[model samples]
Structures are given as structure tokens and as C-alpha cells.
Target: MIDLLEIPGFVLDDEREELLAELRAIPGTAATVLSQDMGGRVQPNVRKTTRLAVSPETRERVKEWLMDAKDVLAARFGVALGDCEDPQFLRYEEGDFFVPHQDGNTPLVHDASRFRRVSTVIFLNERSGEPRQGAYGGGPLVLHGHYRTHPGLRVEAPADPGTLVAFRSETTHEVTPVTHGVRYTIACFFRAADAP
Candidate 1:
């Protein structure tokens, strides 16, 4: 089975609401995909989401929270993790989606992302199948199993608000298209402690 760590209530409700309000007010640019030789570029067909420009202070605060879980993540994954990269506040509108892809630590990438040891996503709102207030639909975080062993294995992660899900950087995953409402999330990468 693919290993994943789920931390419920990682961000309290009050704090999550405040952060969401602040994020909604900011404009966002198209999120990019890091290529081996092309640096970061926007490939809408590959990753279609908006990357909110969070303030440095906000980023620092989120990074601190992520770092606080370093030990737990290391023990769970058996990998030494150092610091977390600046978290990206993402907003997915209706129809936006990220096709299947690995986060890092894979031969498919040769950029700074190669240093990523663990990948994480913090959900800012709950998910629902039907349209509802403060909830979204169709944007599920799906994790795939090893292609060689179980090519058809796909696990849909829990999407409770304030929940944080983490997995190995090389694990293949994707955010399915949002069919209705908006989906907000915070994403970051933890680097290997010994990375240069």
C-alpha cells in the first residue's frame, strides 16, 4: 500500500477562516510546472490552478507549522527531513485540475524540486459531493500506488478542512478537476536534511 500521513485539525478552524479570508483578497498567478531544462513554466493542461501570492510573513508562519511536524514526518517515513520550502497558497476554481504527476525526487525532474523529500497539502475547506456553503466538489487528492506492483491502485485522500496530508516526494498523485465551487489549499515540500 502507498504510505501517507494524515493529520486532522492541523490548522484550527478560527485560524483557517482568517487565512482563507486573507488569501481570497489577493490576486493569483497561474501555477507552474518545473521542467528539467526549462525552469518553471505554466502548462495549463498539466497543472491548472492559481498560485496566490501570500505575504512573506504568512509564508513564514505556515513554514513554521510545517517544520513543527518534521519529526513526526521523519519517523513516519523513515527519512530525515530538514526545512520546508515556502508554502504555496493555491486556489482551484471550477474546471481547474492537475493531471497525474510526481512531486519530486524522481528522474523526471532535475530542478531544485529534486531535493524535495516529502510533499504535503493542507486543505483549507471541506469537500462535498453536492454544492454547499464553504465546501467544494470533484477536487480530490488522489495518490497512486507503485506502477510495477499495483498499477490500478488509486487512493482518494481525505479532504476535511484543516487536514494535512503528506507522502513521499516520488509518489505519483494528482488533484482531480473541480466541478463546482472553489478549492483552497496550502502546499509545500520538505527537503532532505543533508541536501545541499
Candidate 2:
């Protein structure tokens, strides 16, 4: 049961396009290659996308939005989350996808990797209210619930521009392959302020 709150008009149309242009200039290999949480290795199979450096002005806006939504998130996820990591902007072109995985912990990996309390993905692209109007095809954020207990339950969060979806980091989720246009997004990971 993931409570995905759709945030309309979070990023204005102009701003989104500006950010997209900045990402397009970077070479895929350099911008997209990032270390995985499991083994600290750069892997594209598990997660593939380029990281966009967010400007300070944009960061301030996001931080304010997060603070304003704290209560809603806390009530929905049943946890007091604080301190969000600097979000990474990601661009997913045709055939790109992220395999199902949890963001919280990975067996023996210590350090700051254990603090991911909440996971967030903010979509950036004009999305028509109609399903067919989606600029890009596929790339739905599929949340895999407990199969046995929550039997046959799955939540699909479409990548619509200006939409924000947040969930517990422990939940298993994946980004389905994009069949059409490129998909742009920002990944935000939050940690509990008081965690050890």
C-alpha cells in the first residue's frame, strides 16, 4: 500500500526544460555512470541514468517543499524522515529500466548507506491528462508489494511531468523500460534524523 502523492506544478515548464537541456549536454557514460549501494561498483544493469547537478536555487525550492510535506509523508509512511540527500537528476531513454530493488540496506554495507528512510522520484515532462498523451511510453514506477501476504497487489506510478511519488525505502520497486520518448526524473533519498 504505497501512498503516492501527485504534486502538480512543482517545477514550472520552463524550469524543467532548462534542466533537461543541461543534462543532454553531458556524455551518457560520464553523466549516467554511478556507484551502486550494494558493492560500490558502477553498474548500469541494476540502475541506468545520468546524474544532473541541481543548482542551489532549485535545491532551496525542493527543500522547502519537502519540509511543507513532512507531516503528510510521516503520516503516510509511519516514520519521521529528515535530511534528504542532494537529489540526482536522471534521464531514461528508450529501453532504459531499473530492476526491482530496495534502497535501504544491502547485507554488510555499512556507513551512510543504511540511512535511506524514504525514496522519491519526481517526473519531469509534459504529460497529457490522457494516458495516450504521455510524451513517452512505458517507464512506469512499479512497486512490488509482499507477494504472499499482499497477494497480487502492485502499484504503478506513471512518469508524468511535475508528479512526485514517495515511498518507504524498504519497498521493492523498479522502473519499467521506456518504449518511446526519453524520460527525465530526479531521485531523492531521505534519512531519519535520529538514526544511528
Residue 118 in model 2: lDDT: 80
Taken over the whole model, the C-alpha lDDT of each candidate is 0.91, 0.70
Deviation in angstroms for 136 in model 2?
Answer: 2.0
| Residues 1-196, model 2: lDDT tens digits | 6545566666677877776676666555423322344345546777665565566776676666666766777778788877777676777777888888777744554656577778878788753323454366777888887656674678897556777788887777888888777777887777887865
On TM-score, the leading prediction is: 1
Per-residue error for 66 in candidate 2, Å, reads: 3.3
Error of 1 at 86 (Å): 0.6
What does each candidate score in C-alpha RMSD? 1.7, 3.7
14-103 per-residue lDDT for model 1 (tens digits): 989989998889999999886323388899999999999888888888899999999999999999998888788999999999999988
Give candidate 2's TM-score: 0.78
Q: For candidate 1, give the lDDT of residue 186.
A: 95
